[model samples]
Target: MTPPATPTSQGRPDKPALTVLYDGACPLCRREIGVYRRLDALAPGATVCYADISDAAVPVPPGATRDHLLARFHVQDRDGVLLSGAQAFLALWRHLPGWRWLALLGRVPGAVWVMERSYRLFLRVRPRLQRWAARLD
Candidate 1:
């Protein structure tokens, strides 16, 4: 069984539950991340780190290139396991408060598989969405 989450003196977790790699330059991505960040602020027990892969200063995981990270959603869990697409989103959702239900759904048999497929479809149109979102900025 997992132990209860505890915050460090700095009010951050001793080890982050997940580190999210995102394309900070993308307006759509920023809006989504902003919602997650606000939810994270409301629930402090679990620590979620957000890294802007679009920023050269942010570090990329070993075996992953900057372009690869920027192209998709990715997250590193507490155990150092790297997950992308639906898996990454699930890991992140499990850390948040209200979003935990969505993460729980991911545990259902084949749910992740279906979600992954949907995410892949989204990737095909992501560039178009990004362009549209950028225009709104």
Candidate 2:
């Protein structure tokens, strides 16, 4: 089964929408999503579905559990490809303006390796950052 469409502002029918499944409960995640949302809103012809996976009412991805969604960043590209972690972020940046250059750079031979490793390291320290963010809120 496929996910539903993300109706564009112009209502033009196209390929499947690029949807970013995010954890709204996490301050870090929310901040990043907020940036992407703003960028997408300003970019013409860009339509992204921002799903709050932390919401109890939101449906879980086809085969993924809610915990899996919270553990890592996930994105469903227009091709219906599911991407996670650094790749997911890279895919998303490709749709945003200025950031598209960085996304292109990610396709370099060694860039993805480094980016994935960095994402793993960030995951390890995410708990501490979340705590700090919570305190700041």
Candidate 3:
């Protein structure tokens, strides 16, 4: 299904609503991204795109290095704004069918702040989780 022509702040509709940048090499990340991919495929007129940042062939966004992007969860919005951490997840959840409620919850005052803090904690242990997931592969 074709995405609706939603205008960005600059009045452009050429860009997809989101472009998710992910580390394909990380088993944990790959599995999570797989879930999103399946959901996106099932959603009619889904406007989210995925970019495997681990792949050398994928072009990194301007002013961002591949390593920096791979180090965190990131999504580029329709206006080409790059969001990281919980903000990125919130943006993605808003688009996914079953996940929109969580996005709404995130909109509550201080909810995103808490989520971002928790995400920062997760980042600290992500390498260990990645190693464990790789072992299961």
lDDT of each: 0.86, 0.85, 0.88
Give the TM-score of each candidate: 0.88, 0.88, 0.88
Q: Candidate 1: where are CA atoms >4 Å away?
A: 1-7, 10-13
Clashing pairs in 2: none
Looking at model 3, report the run of 10 residues with the lowest lDDT sum.
1-10
Per-residue lDDT of candidate 3, residues 1-137 (tens digit)? 12235566687876688989999999999999999999998898778988898999888888889999999999988777899999999999999989999999896899999999999999999999999999999
**What's model 3's lDDT at 124?**
99
- Error at 70, model 3, angstroms: 0.7
Candidate 1 global lDDT: 0.86
Over 30-108, each residue of candidate 2 has an lDDT whose tens digit, in order, gives 9989899888989877767788989988887677888998899999877767899889999888888778898998878
In candidate 1, what are the lDDT values of residues 11-49, reduced to their tens digit? 874767778889999998999999999999999464887
TM-score of 1: 0.88
Q: Where does candidate 2 have its weakest 10-residue lDDT segment?
A: 1-10
lDDT of 3 at 92: 98
- Clash number for each model: 0, 0, 0
